[model samples]
Target: MEGFEIRLTSSKKGKGLFATKKYDQGDVILEEDPLVSCQFAWNAAYRYLACDYCMRQMHYPPETTSIMLLVRILAYIQQSSDPSAAIAKVKQFCHRTENEDAELVHKLLGEQFTHQMNTLREMTSHVVSGDEVQEFLTPEGFCTLMALVGTNGQGIGTSPLAMWVNSVLEITMSDDERQQLDLFIDKLYQYVEEESGSFLNTEGSGLFQLQSSCNHSCAPNAESTFPYGNHRVQLKALKPIMPGEEICISYLDECTLQRSRHSRQKELAQNYLFVCWCERCSSQASEPDCTSEEEMSDEDIDADD
Candidate 1:
């Protein structure tokens, strides 16, 4: 909100962020904390642990993914006396299409919800007087949460000692006495990683009310970064911008910039449910014609984490 303002005009791309004043390259536009954040589930195959809240990488590996975070959010909503307000906020996000390739996204969301419910039931089955499950846990609510995450979640990167220590301790220590020793090793590793300057942790995903308003542009003028160690993220200017210019950011990886117009548009459409009409896309289209079937190199495809 420092250098930008939200414009909700119908002419614009739904809700979008716009510059309030001129900004030079590298100027910090806005620094904001997330409305909600969850640590990513660690994948044994990938051997990376990201923060549940900010998606920052930890010392060891991630054990729970976004689905775990979604379960946490749902539990919070169920415990609330009135969850209507929270549901209303989630409903604001755009939902994925049912026709998308193999219905993968839809299927995954459904599966994760079912898994969470079953896990909760098993955990509490032995309890004599467990709380009754909330009635609001429905397919509609699940889809709404998924849509909110798919559309608005921002990937943050940072190094936090507590996240690293807790993750490492959880895996290494089973008793209180051993936990103390594990903590020491955790602190030592953290210091080593920091001193080596080789740490690039993907802490977790977060939802931001202000940053989410910025739409995607292949040639974006603004870039989001997590400079602060906590959940705070900053949106910085990538180039000079005049007042009233739409402050855009790239939803895909930076490598997408090197891809052809056809490739970029296809990726955007499939993943984001939108076609690119930005200046870069337009300019590329006007250039030399290329086959739509041009194969993307293996390097162009980002490895799934």
Candidate 2:
């Protein structure tokens, strides 16, 4: 963490994280394990939990040890209010425990709770969901969604879970957190391919990691060529960035229109706690004519004349 820095840099709008050192094309940034890696399971006492989309089961064992771990993960996900806050809240509603408390759980799990939580949040948020899946999985769109649930995009929007969760759970965003998230989320649209094209996993891998210093963007300055074996992420320069420039990657797929992407970013910001000022957000503010109706009407008027 010394040679590398996750330092904030100046931007016209606000602040963004950048690399203070010169990072080579395939340099390693940050790597860690997932906090909660339970397989998809249903009717395993961890019931009512399933993949956000597809209704696929998220496997989990029901041994005493596994139950303890699952309880702790549910607590962490609930208390921290990360992107999985909605799902966490639902679990809490169903789980009414007499002896369990947040303080006791943290004491038992120790740093694993914090470390894995942050790392899981980062890896899931930044590395898993984008073109990385296209590099690794077939039936590419499913890979993207799978990678998405594996990250922050999980169990929220675009799922039947939202209807049930929304009815029972209330997730509120503070104004400041919402603003910061707004800037961070708007950029994911520029990097990921939209058609859900196929990604070939040259090697079988489940995990990937990136340097924490890399900034978040919809249109990122760098792209990752993901490797197999836990899907380790390899960074590549997408453009000719100057030395000391902050390298960034999109946390979401790029296969969406600017309006759709921006709207999602706004929602993510309110949910995840960061404002997005990525290049796309910047340029889109100054550019014109993203409206489809306007272009269609102009064509009709021209034909009449």
| Stretches of model 2 off by over 4 angstroms after superposition | 1-3, 9-17, 24-32, 35-213, 224-226, 231-236, 257-275, 288-290, 293-305
Candidate 1 deviant stretches above 4 angstroms: 9-12, 43-64, 76-82, 94-104, 107-136, 159-201, 287-305
Error of 2 at 119 (Å): 26
**Alpha-carbon TM-score of each model against the true structure:** 0.66, 0.37
> What are the lDDT scores of the predictions, listed in order?
0.63, 0.40
Give the alpha carbon lDDT tens digit for every residue of 49-159 in model 2: 543222232222221333223333434444553645534332322111222222223333354644533443444334334332222222332222232222221111122
> 23-48 in candidate 1: lDDT tens per residue?
99999998887767765554333455
Top model number, TM-score: 1
